[model samples]
Target: MNHSNLKIRARDERILVIDDDLGVGECIQCMLRIAGYESAFVTTAAAGLERAQSEAFDLVVSDLRLPDRSGIDVLRALREAGQDTPVILMTSYSSIESAIEALRTGATDYIIKPFNNDDFLYSVERALDEQRMRKENAMLKRSLKRVYSSRRIIGESEGILRVLDMIRRVAASDANVLIEGESGTGKELVAQAIHYASPRAEGPFVPINCGAIPAELLESELFGHAKGAYTGAVAASEGLIREASGGTLFLDEISELALNLQVKLLRVLQERQVRPLGSKHTYATDARFVAASNRDLKQAMEQGLFRADLYYRLNVITIHVPPLRERGRDVEILAQHFIEEHSRRLGKRITGMSPAMRDFLYSYHWPGNVRELENLIERSVILAEGSVLSLEDPPAKGTTAPAPGTAGEFLDRPLPVEEYMKEVVRRYQDSHSEMELAAMLGVGRKALWMRRRRWGLYRSGDSRREGTGKGDLKRSA
Candidate 1:
């Protein structure tokens, strides 16, 4: 038969065929080869089972009846031996009942004795495809686990070491966790590490920022709406709580949750079940809860901004991630880490910071925490010319007067917030891009442009600097 038009999707997949008849076994082997698979045939059930148990095969094909043992026996034996290879059974019309039983017992597919080549090949391809998907899914889960593992947390400060220890201790339990820290203090990262380190690592890790979504839509998002539940509801939905079944649910900025939602969430925590919107019935869920907030919940409860009972429920285990200022020596470590990371990503050769720049970093108060440090390092790397990163816009210490046309020069004289900001923008506009200037001022690009227009300031000519050049004060390097 001509097989030139056959579509082969198999990638050297190993297949084993077991049959008492040599002719049928050889035919199946030949078909597997034509489909771009590697194949071997065995004459008896014992030999096939032995070979399958000894070697790894992607798929196994066996006849329903053998001289010594039946295919059902083979399936059971393989299962008992912890083998999950896909199995296909071949049977005659008279043995159709046995074939169905084999399927119920765990056979991947069944083919009749007089089955056409096309039908047989289709079953083989389908079974192999499913197995491949399972393998890929398992690999992806493993990768996620590795990426979110507690060992991946970067820091060696005492506070950070204590947090790591707490993570390890709490990961073995199913109690709800509450992580408290300032914004950008890596609270979500801690939550992820706890989830991946826990027994529920194989399950999904669903995270939702409570403060980001509006209160009106946040309810439906958390407790999904059913079909026709609202004006725009087009289909039934299973909410995030239900979707997190047998996994973990990370609620970031939980203090931002509305009071009404807090009551509903407390009920779900107490009952271990969730009721979807516009649905009368509530279903049980088995998800572990991990909540985080930058605010103090106790204070929030006293101020009537948060529910007392809900806070108590979520505070069974508390982990406080220290602010970057409190983590001494970690600043330099994280700075160097970010420098290398952003350097490689941006294709720069920045190996380290100048001594004066390092001193400036050490003295500065990191109000925005690790996130701000990483951003600064990335921006500096983008504008770095030499192998070392040096301060340009913000000049280093020990200078009577700031460099010409630099924002630092304005620091010597007192000015209003508006005028100071304007000078900073006008002086640095030549050296920095629009985005960089806006970020320094803690405003959006549009806002910066509006201010510039109000002040009648505009880029003179090629205002954007490619990298740090002459006039950059190198105090000590």
Candidate 2:
């Protein structure tokens, strides 16, 4: 090692050296200091083991033959004590059997007695780097557990409390789960909570949207494909099912799966094995299935859009996530949560939202559920100039209500067509049903529903926002 070229800094990683020869032990200590490392030396294995147990060490360098005991004994003692510090064994006799024994006994590296300073330094660096990586991976897993824990789901309403209770109860079981909720209602979050809290917490959580991938490729995507299976096939692949072994496979929007593909999925669920596309062999899988959908699968099966057999196979347990509109006070609570979360991320000091803005958030029917509220709050926080956030309400003629004045203002000025429509809907949605609004707007009911969804204008009491005139319009828009 080039001592002059090396950076001079305090290396806090302490290494312990155990050798019978005082000369060799002192030499190794000098080399460690030259490399800017903290180290200590003990002449006997007994003394070395004593210091190792009492003190913290990043690594240990020990002679294979000691005056009191063999380095293998020291390694075994550490392992028995549950200490994971890496050990490097040094010996004058270089034999494959001894090297294998040292490694099997948990030695990080086995070095000959006549090794060079560069080689020694290289081994030390490699061992430390591997230990660092292991620690980092452990920390990352811990952080993910905290992030996906059930407590992370933010809400205090009865609907949210019920969902949380269900998650806690279901997390102890290995049965398959089906989550039903509208888009943006945090079905995936519930799935994550279940996986992270269950025995599969340490295992992988693989999520794939059934509607995102094409029908032709979804089979291979789920079950994997052999090399040369298709036009673009180059290498054999283990599909998401195998990847989720001992973990969870979350199939989002399972209702979008084609009828033909549904039969294949049903078979896999029943057999607990997957046959890759164009492959003769089938691999067993131990993954727990967690499927989610915004649509009603029972209705879909009745319409022949989804298979009844597959539905029963995946619906071992059911979790229904209520829409944000039904989660009354949770709306304001979530809005505040997002405000604080985004404000800190964007380097702003926003304290809270204005009282009127809070009231508006509470009153407005969140057509897109939690997702829409989060996006709106994030945008508001980004554009907010003052410490408190405020919503820019439509120019109202009076405090009684903005509906009539906002509609009249749209007629007085030539605004964008969308803005005009939004104002008109806001003014009259409380009194108008879906059919009434569609007929008055000269559009179909589906078109009216899409427009309402686009503008976040679902009528009050319309939790799922089916837009089929099921919502009560007595509440103001």
Candidate 3:
């Protein structure tokens, strides 16, 4: 915390006073100020609750009886609205039962009416102290989550935020989490964020790709293999389930698991135990499962490819990562991140992207999602010749409109095959070297040389070296 804020908070604590009686409100306000606190009063419970919801206060001092409602009603409404500020109810012995009800409903304490100055001051101090403890506990929980993780979900788009909010809701428990998204959409990144924020953060996190490994070998990999259990089993091996004893096991591409293997996985989730191959003994596992897939598992189940029981077990809390095209301007954010990252690796001094490049990235539909963006940026950084990323660098594909005068324009709209190829060579033939121009047109230098010769567009002076044509190409566009 900043020391300036700390010093100010220590000197000027704020308190809210709620009482229908103006006399009572003034009396409590006076007492709070004398005790070195700033206080505000509202005459009705409705006005007081509105202030509490919209403003920040260190503690609340409220009379048990108000014109509109009892202090207990205010306390319950505050709690239901997610307000945790400490509350002290003012009461009289004639309504001892009501005061007791307020305390049970989360009032820090109750001050008896006609109480001495010492009693009232003591109650205020106690309530403020409890509020301080609550803030400290919340801060420590957030600090612990940060210490356990360097990886986090990074997109701020509405679609991405919904997926992140889902993870936040379920991360404190051991509930199984299922993440579904397209390939290259960073499904594994979501799993890491959940695992590191969870209560089992200090334990290991093991991951396996069900689609990358052979189906016959997947069972042995998950449940382990005893010595001489299979053809390549030279020694006893502990599997991923045992490896993730007290933490999480992330299974990527979960829909790729075969039907028989899905049945075995279901047993482990149901029984919390796995028996190794060629062994009679079973070992207990306390691992939380996080599964991810790009394919529609529900569709797979309907086709009788994936087991229904397994699907229901793993999808207790489902989060769908949004595709890059659907994530608004997150592509530009991620592109900047990748550009900075690769700039350091590639030893380039790049600072930022051009406006046209940023606009192009926002307009394009990224089928490969984040991974495609990262790879394309890495390639751009490697080939970049200046500090700011050149708009002409990334290879354009498909039908999106390119910035005026880019090689991307030729590829954007359809033209006759031969005319399109000749136009591409002629347009970029000046701004770039022969090799660079050839690469942009998706052809070899020899083919480029032949095209210049074939179209009679070669510069008149240097026929072989420079391919500049005699045509005043301003007429063609």
Question: Which candidate leads the pack in TM-score?
Answer: 1
lDDT of 3 by residue, 1-477 (tens): 011211122346789999887876787776666566898899889999999998888888888888898888999999999788888888664466776687789989887777777767767777777788877886686577655443346677999889777877888999998999876788988888888778777678899998768788998999998999988899987799999989999999899898888988999999999988888889999999999988799999999989999999999999999988789878888888888889998889989888878877876545456876776677778877888775677443211122344445554555644576577556555545665554444444555665677786643334443345453222121
Instruction: Say which prediction, candidate 1 or candidate 3, comes out ahead on lDDT.
Output: 1
Q: What is the C-alpha RMSD of each candidate to the true structure, in Å?
A: 12.8, 12.0, 18.0
lDDT of 2 by residue, 342-424 (tens): 99999999999778787767665454578767766776777778898775522112221232334444455655445655776
Model 3 quality (TM-score): 0.55
Candidate order, TM-score descending: 1, 2, 3
Residue runs of model 2 more than 4 Å from their true location after superposition: 1-93, 96-144, 393-477
My TM-score estimates for the predictions, one after another, are 0.62, 0.61, 0.55
Model 2 sits at a Cα RMSD from the real structure of 12.0
- The sequence of per-residue lDDT tens digits that candidate 1 reaches over residues 92-138 is 74465676688799999877777778778889889999999998998
Candidate 3 residue pairs that clash: 459-468
Give me the displacement of residue 98 in model 3, in angstroms. 64
Better of 1 and 3 by TM-score: 1
What is the model-wide C-alpha lDDT for candidate 3? Answer: 0.76
